[model samples]
Structures are given as C-alpha cells and as structure tokens.
Target: MSRQFAILGLGYFGSTVARELKRHQNQILGVDRDESRVDALSDMLDHAVIADLTDEKALAELSLETYDAVVIDVDGNLEASVICTLHVKELGAKEIWAKAHSDAHYKLLKRLGADRVIYPEYDAGIRVAESLNYHAMVDFIRLGERQFIVEVETTERLVDNCKSVAKLAIDRDSLFLVAIKRGEEVIQNPSNDTTLQAGDNLVLMGDLDALREIGKQI
Candidate 1:
C-alpha cells in the first residue's frame, strides 16, 4: 500500500511539507481553514479539506485510521493547535507531529499526546546562523546521533587533481567522501583520480573540527 499522510495547515511550512510528500508518492490529505488554500493544494494532494480541525466534531468525522501520519502545522493559533492535537489523540491517530511556536505551546502539545513537536522556525534560524557565522560550513546535515554530514568549501587549494582524497588524508586526517556534486551530476565514491575543483561541492561525513580544517584547505 502507498504511504498516507495528513497535513493540517496551509501556510508556508505546512504547504511545503504537503507538496514534498507528494513528490515521494505518498497519498496526502491537506487541511486548512481557508478554502483558497485547499484549492491551491488540490492539484498536489490526494485530498484537500477546508475545515477547522479544532472543532472536535469536525475532526471526529474523519477516519483517523485512514492516515498513517498526521502533522499539525497551524502555527498562528495556539488554542486551535491544542484542541486539534487533543482531538486527534482522542480519535486514536497513531503518529502525530505538531509544530510549536513557543515553549509553552510545545509543552501543551506534549501533554495532549503529540508524538513529536517540531520548532521549525527556531531550527531554521539556528541553521541560518551557523551557515552565516561559520563560513567554513558550506552545508550541514545531521546524520543520526551526534555525527553530521557537511560540505565545506576549501580555501587553500581552489582545485586539486594532484592526489586522491585518500592520499590527501594520509597527512591531513581523512573525512569520508560521500559524493562529489559537480555541476548537475553527482559522482558517488569518487576515485583517487577525482580532482577537487573550486566550484565543485564535496559531500563529506565527519565531525565539525575536521570539517573546519578541510574548509580552510579548499
């Protein structure tokens, strides 16, 4: 069976997630308070409902078991968010993820039995700060646990075809080379002959300090 998901919001973050889920071939149900939002997402989602899910009776009308996962993205209204979360839990949805605008909201969602409460805006701000403040970090992605996958732009050698990444590692500690994205093509597990180019982005796996050093040597 295909994956199924429900997103209860029509704003930027909510709509983006709804569309992205469709790209992965999931059956998406997008719910919003505005009919305009429902119409806009109609082409992208399997179903679109313009209903205030905070209304307990309206929420109870939908079969919660039909959706595998449900996400609450209504960040503007705290009362609505709390009510909807409680309603979904009461309706027996197995997995529930909600967005929280503040610490109090996050705690409320937890008490209402939401499985996960995401602070999207807060997380984005942190990432933006890291990218801007640390010039060394070209790209950062958390890879389970505390490890991170990062792409760092090297400052030293603009480009290098001289030695393989392994050879370069012999002296300057080696970070795993996940892939080399050059132009549109991505070269996975690049060989020793692969020359690091200035514009070429290296997808690497390692810790922050090592990545910082690699960042300085590009």
Candidate 2:
C-alpha cells in the first residue's frame, strides 16, 4: 500500500521534500503560498494549491485527515510556519514533521504537536564537518555516548588487502562490524571472513573512540 504525504511551503526545502518524496512509493500533495509555485508544481505533484497557510479557515479546508505524513517547511516566515504547524496538528494529520531554523524554533514546533522537528541546514553542516574530518566515512550516526555506527565507503585496500575481520577486531579492537552498504545491496550481519571490495559501503558499529582509532588506521 502507498502512503500519503503533504509538504507545505514551496521554497527550496518544501519543493525538495516534494521531489524526493515522489522518488518513493507514496501519494504527495504540495502546498505553497506562492501562486507561481503552486501553478508550477500542479502538474508535477498529486495535488498543488496556493493558499496562505496562516489563515486558519483556509488551512481547515485542507484534507489533512487523508495524509499519513505532513511536512512543514515554511521558511522565511517564522510566524506562518508556527501557525501552519498548529493548523496541521489540529487537522489531525497522522505524523507531523516540521523543519526548524533554530533550537528555539525546534522546541516551539515540538510543543505545538510536531512529531519530529528537523534542522536540515544544521544537520547538513554537521555532515559536511564530519566528511571534511574523516575521508573514510560517508555518514555517521551517534548511537550512544561511546557507541556509533558509520557508513564508510569500502575500498579495494580494505576489502582485498585488509586482513580478516576477526584479526582486525583483535588487532584494531573494533567491537562490531554490523553490515555492509554495498551501493544498493545491504548485507546485514556480514561475515567476519567476508572480503571488503571497492564500491562497497561498510556499516560498522562500535565504541566511538575505538572506531575513531580504526578509522584513523583506514
């Protein structure tokens, strides 16, 4: 079954979300306060409309009851974004996702019934910082104080030339080698004896400090 989603606002964040959602198996309805944006996306989206989301009556006209998820990304206007969040929550949308510009905004959105609040620009900045510091890492997830899971690009050196994962564990002291993200193929709980290859991505889990040690070696 296909899930349904609505994206409010039509600036970069909103439009980007709409486009990306279309890549998945879902029904997406787009909302924008700009007439040109609404018109442009009309043919591209399942439904697109031009309406001031801050207008409570106008927002009430939206069929949020039908959507499984609602994403609010009304950037450039803080008041409208907050109002939109409130309206969507009141409309009884299943999941309300809001994009926030700051910590204060995040808290406000969460308090206003947003299920999840995303700081997209800040998150992307963090990712860029991680990338700049660690060439081996494609992505990083901090699971606990010490534990972390990293999506690292596999090289022929790591795959063919690197020693067995068992010895690597002993020598390098990496706790868990969870999975290998080989492009689109995800190998869960990969074998200790399995060879790493170029074009493969390894999802490794272990103490962050220990992984940093292994990461430095690689």
Q: How does each model score on TM-score?
A: 0.83, 0.88
Model 1 has an lDDT value of 0.79
RMSD of each: 2.9, 2.3
Runs of candidate 2 with Cα error greater than 4 angstroms are 155-161, 170-174
| Candidate 2 lDDT, 20-78, residue by residue in tens | 88878678888888898888878779888788888877777878878889899897677
Candidate 1: lDDT of 86? 89
Summarize candidate 1's per-residue lDDT along 1-218 as a digit string, tens digits: 57999898888888998989889989998888899989988988888888987887777776765789899988688998898898899888989999999889999999989999999778888788878876656768887655678876544454553345654452234467888887898989888777766567778887666665555565
Q: Which ten residues in a row have the lowest lDDT in candidate 1?
A: 165-174
lDDT of each: 0.79, 0.80
Candidate 1 residue runs with Cα over 4 Å from true position: 143-146, 154-156, 160-164, 167-174
